[model samples]
Target: MTRHTVNASILLTDRPLLERPAAARAAGFDAVEFWWPWPQTATPSADQVDAFVAAIEDAGVQLTGLNFFAGDMPAGERGIVNNPARQDEFRANVDLVVEIGERLGCKHFNALYGLHADGIDEEAEAEAARANLSYAAKAVDAIGGTVLLEPVSGAEAYPLKKAADALAVIDSVGAGNIRLLADFYHLAVNGDDVAAVIAEHAQDFGHIQIADAPGRGAPGTGDLPLDTWIKAAQDGGYDGPIGLEYIAGEGDPFAWVQA
Candidate 1:
């Protein structure tokens, strides 16, 4: 059977992360992903982590990936890449992600490209993103995992929004372990041809996240061509989990996209 996973971030906001395994399983998801696991907000403590791991195992649910290191604390606007001042913080974040992956046996990690500073040269930003990706790739490589560099929408300062721009940064990084993570809502937000773009970057795509275009809700809740894009993804040789990273609509988001 083909496997598709939903992120716990979408379905279990009312409960803590440690309690998400049961929720995901109850929702008929065989595997799940999450945004971040740090500082004990959404993440569990060490003992809780162990318990959560056991719960998932007992429930027969897998963790597909983790979106790591969203932004600098407090402000939470800018990303680790393209911000020279946050390189150390970025490295530390990468370490934490790797450690979590090791404990959880996850194979994929996603990095959010935060906003850039004003007056920053585009080329310089690309170079900085490439360098940061390279560092993350190495860290992921050491753990036998791959890193997906995601270009988010709704952020004007993000250097990479278009598929071509993200591909360029991935090429510059030149790390075999680093790949592109395409988010459907973000692609639509940035006005990219979603199906065509995914087809074009098929080989470089490591994972996919999906939601409705306008409100980032469940598939079919908005105007994104989810069926078309999903077909295109299959044609492009993407065999990993299709992540449901959207806001829950009136009911189960998975119901809208069931094949």
Candidate 2:
């Protein structure tokens, strides 16, 4: 049977941030993942981290994946890894992310590459990203974790919109722990042939997130063949949990999964 992990950040928005893990458990999922919870500051207070840890522990859910601190996601910032000014800020969060992972036994972390910033040359941005990714890789290595690079859609200025695009950066990083995050919704939104991508690069993926295309809703809400695509990923050797990162809208978000 296929295992699923809820994206607590997006899925259980009706509840408090610390309460989402329990909500996911109540929805019948045993595992969960999240984007950086503290969007405004990379370094959240010790009490804040403790509460997050307690939430997951109290919920009895496994934290399957996490994103390192990206900038204010609500404000449209994708990440800080590639920004020259925020390089230090990105670096500062690496250890904290790793510390959380160590406490939670979570091994997968996503690192979002920011859009091209003004006044910074392309070379400088690329260099900073590579250096930071390498640093994150090294830190996570201590905990035997993997750093994930995902291709996003809807943000035209945000680079790495394809599997190959992220793979090239992984190559440059040259860390075995660095791998691709195959978010099917984003890939399909960006006009990628999802089936072909699954067939050709399933082995390259470290994690998989899903939502239907066009609507970014539950699997049945759109035209994408999510079942077939998931089967393809499985056939191609993807053994990880599937992340439910969709917009639930009004009705039951997990109704499809239950059915």
The TM-scores of all predictions, comma-separated, are 0.87, 0.98
Residues 130-222 of candidate 1: C-alpha lDDT, one tens digit per residue: 778889899889879998877678767676788777777778778998888988788889988887887787767889888887888887778
Candidate 1 positional error at 40, Å:
8.5
lDDT of 2 by residue, 111-174 (tens): 9999988777989999999999999999999999999999999899888898878989999989
Worst 10 residues of 1 by lDDT: 36-45
- lDDT, residue 25, model 1: 87
lDDT of each: 0.76, 0.93
| C-alpha lDDT of residue 64 in model 2 | 96
- Give the C-alpha miss distance for residue 95 in model 2, angstroms: 0.2
